[model samples]
Target: MNFDNNKLIKIIKFNLCFIITFIPSIMYLHLVEGGQTATELWDSFINLDFYSYYKMIFFLTASFFLLITFLKYVDLNGIKKTNYYLPAAVYSILAVLSSFRAEYKEIVIKGFPDRYENIFVLLGYLLLVVVAVNIVDNKKSFKLILKALFISAFILAIHGILQFYNYDLLATEFGRKLITPDGLDFFVDRLSFVGKKVIYSTMYNPNYVGSYTSMVGILALGLYSSSQKKNKLFISGILSTLLFSFLIGSRSRAGFMGFIAGTVIILYMQRQFLKKHWIRIFVIFTVFTLVFITMNARNLDEIFSDVLFPRTEQEKYLEGEILPPITEVSSEAGKLKLKTTEAEFEIIMASDQIEFLNKQPINVYNSKDEVKEIIFKGKQYLHHSFQINEKENYLIWNYGAKSAQFYYQDGQILMAGMHNNLYPLKKVESIGFKGYERLGSSRAYIWSRTLPLLKDTIFIGHGPDTYAMYFPQDDVIGKLKFFSNPEIIVDKPHNLYLQVAVNTGIISLLALLYLWGNYIFSSFVLYKNSDLSSWKNRLGIALMGAVTAYLVAGFFNDSVISVAPVFWIILGLGISLTILAKGN
Candidate 1:
């Protein structure tokens, strides 16, 4: 006991590391890249920052080096050290096997810079976690983690509020400007959403606004659980806005699921104290939900159907009507048939309101109110990013009247006709709704074609970052049915498990089993182990629920293997767990 008791908290509370990690951590929620895609997940190589990657890389290596230094400084019994070592060893072995299985195995080992640059990022992260764990030895460190959470979350909450208000009071005069990995000026277009100019923070996607907000809300709930009121007003207020910000980031299923699940976990964790104040909690939730709906009600159905529904239903949506290939000779014929059918559709407006509204451009962003009034409030409230270009019919002006209304009408019609005949004869019936008529969602088809490649490499599997090399080049996507938009460059397996299996073979399965096994096993321990701290049990429940939600959401998403933040968050939790387990 060389260190003072108070000195431990001060030392464990590493401020700079927390700040840097917080900025990038919010980027995990940047699921939508300029609203073009649902998720902003990037491939491992593409994930590194364009200019900042080097800076981050330097710090990443430094963090690991610091861990090595710490291990020698403190006499860690072999048990704690070995626990940290197991994950690293597993990760390293898998990495090695994958490199050998990679299309560019030679580059991974000897020269190494050419193909396997991204795998190094994974290695760097593992090392960072291992080092961070050494700093986290006991309950006091856990309390320090809470302090880090409170400060970082408070900052993030304020940032999220400004985002909803379409005001960027932080650094730049102008609001957020998001550039692609290739530096295209695509994000400039989304100036108005629901009539308000959309603003972004260091957190990339507005959808990510939900992630940061939800995280802070969970942490605030933890604080509230302890009945600490030093920052009660600030914490509750932040949680309130976070709830509202989610609605503003419409169409993000992950955001909705993550927030709701996070909230449920919090209420449960805080039940012992919060039971009497259930009415207040309910009121808080209602106000939050109402604000979100007011800002984005058209998205309500989607939130209900897609985000809130159980996992099995979503998987069914993904598996949708897979029709056999169409070998038609004439593209013109297909287009003509589609056009004529659409024209002759008598325009069966999905609902009576569409027809009854006298067809005044039929715009509705999200509301059941007078729609005209909603249109006005929407202008004042939502679309904080861009204004309605009334001159251009394509602009979104109202919460329930602008693009959202159009999306809803179109979405419902598309859904109603889910099994509708594609052509005069027949072709892919199980098309993804909201997927444009011209091309059934390209993601599913791309995955379908890649299935065979996965089968061939089922053993050791293909290497990480090798999907581009392994993906079928001569398929319809490459040769025949090329639509525009090359940015959806799916060079790797979209399915998470499949991607893992393809790269690491049965090891991928084993890794998954281990990850899930630990989660399940730990959850049981939390429930059964009476010695555990209340905070640990609550954190465990939250993590378990959050991870479960993520897995279910991932079943329909391409999030797992890429250098996405969600995966990093999972890794962060794993690291935290490893630390939590030590000295227990």
Candidate 2:
């Protein structure tokens, strides 16, 4: 009996370490399907992609291990005693209650099943805290975990660098076929690098990669500073530099700002350590910054233009003169008519904007430039105007089936459609402090629409992940008009605070805040008391920095399956370290 128990514990520990090390690689190995319509029981249970499936397995394994650990050792003391556990418990309870009382029960139950999945996520994180606190009782296990993390970060960073140079290591034709044996083409299309130039790497989004690297990079910095061996320090420094470079290539503004904020906090906390190693740290920072800047100068320039001044390619076109009035207008069976200059012209518009009408003889020119004499089928015609509203100005291009229409005002392209030559107009910019209003990229608009819905469900929200169902009916967002599309459906509030408040109500949001605040505060307190010269204390300080970065980034982004696991694991590690520090 004793031998069996010892063997089981060894197996659990080995599995836990393996899961932690391989998470970064597994993030890219998703089995993409056509859509989210579940046809089987397994599909319904595990609707998300490969990452979620792997996490589910991790959760089950951890739960089983924890159950065995409890039965054999009778150690349920960790959960009962932890300072941050109660808030987490309350948050979980509230989340579960909210799911049951959800207005869109179908959405909560079927559509976006985050409500249930989130329970597992929360439990998994808590279990990690418990298991890590118990298992990693010594410096050796702690070092092993940190080393695994560094290795994962190194692999991800190298892959990202290769991807930036258009070398997709995992996305090759043969590779895709190997991963998806079903020969499903949807996975290829979904994961293929098409229009995007920035490398998403394993996380699938540039923002996610930015977030992941920001946290990992700061942790690497901690490890580098704490290492006693010259070779270990050098390797850690290289890993930190690689992660920082990856963060810059991601081009995520929120992530960049979060990383900067977190690093500053860490530096301030470890001022004593900085006093001794300031020169070396400064050199590393300078070298990495210069390298990143040189590689991404052009990308930065374009991003600055788009974010600050807000100009598009279509802005170059001139607003032409409004032509003569339309005498008559009619439409029948996918064709339109305009009667002017005592001539009736039949026009057919192309359904696809990108496909040019090559079958018909048409004279196309920049509307801003001179309007030439157009003769279609030996009928002379001049530029004609059509007004949807008295205040709105519209330019109509009539040349057989290749007709296009646009709304132009004050030398700017307001809205355009069915024109292969013209670009979509940029949104109307508001003159103000360019932080959230401008840099938020219309998230302000999404949030404004979402706030009004919270009045009815202030205590317990419409339920977890049910934001999509109700968001479409929002007065402002439902009829929200962009360049061509009049109706837009916003699935998320875009802000994590707003997402939590609207999904699970203000009380749940407060509970979540408390949970995070308590952990951060406790971690910082531990860092302040520990020996500044010790590597262990420096690591604790670094973990604090990582948590700070994740929280700041979370303000701009939501927690997803890809990056959330890492955040939780780091949080657990910090908690365990803090406890150990207190004991010492």
Best candidate, TM-score: 2
lDDT of 1 by residue, 66-103 (tens): 45544554543332444445645675578667776566
Tell me the RMSD of model 2 versus the true structure.
Answer: 9.7
What are the candidates' C-alpha RMSDs? 13.1, 9.7
lDDT of model 1 at position 96: 66
Model 1, poorest ten-residue lDDT window? 336-345
Deviation from native of the Cα of residue 436 in model 2, angstroms: 6.5
Candidate 1 displacement at residue 194 in angstroms: 14
Per-residue lDDT over 503-582 for candidate 2, one digit per residue giving the tens place of the 0 to 100 score? 77888789878877887888777776566667668778888898888888776677655576677778778878877777
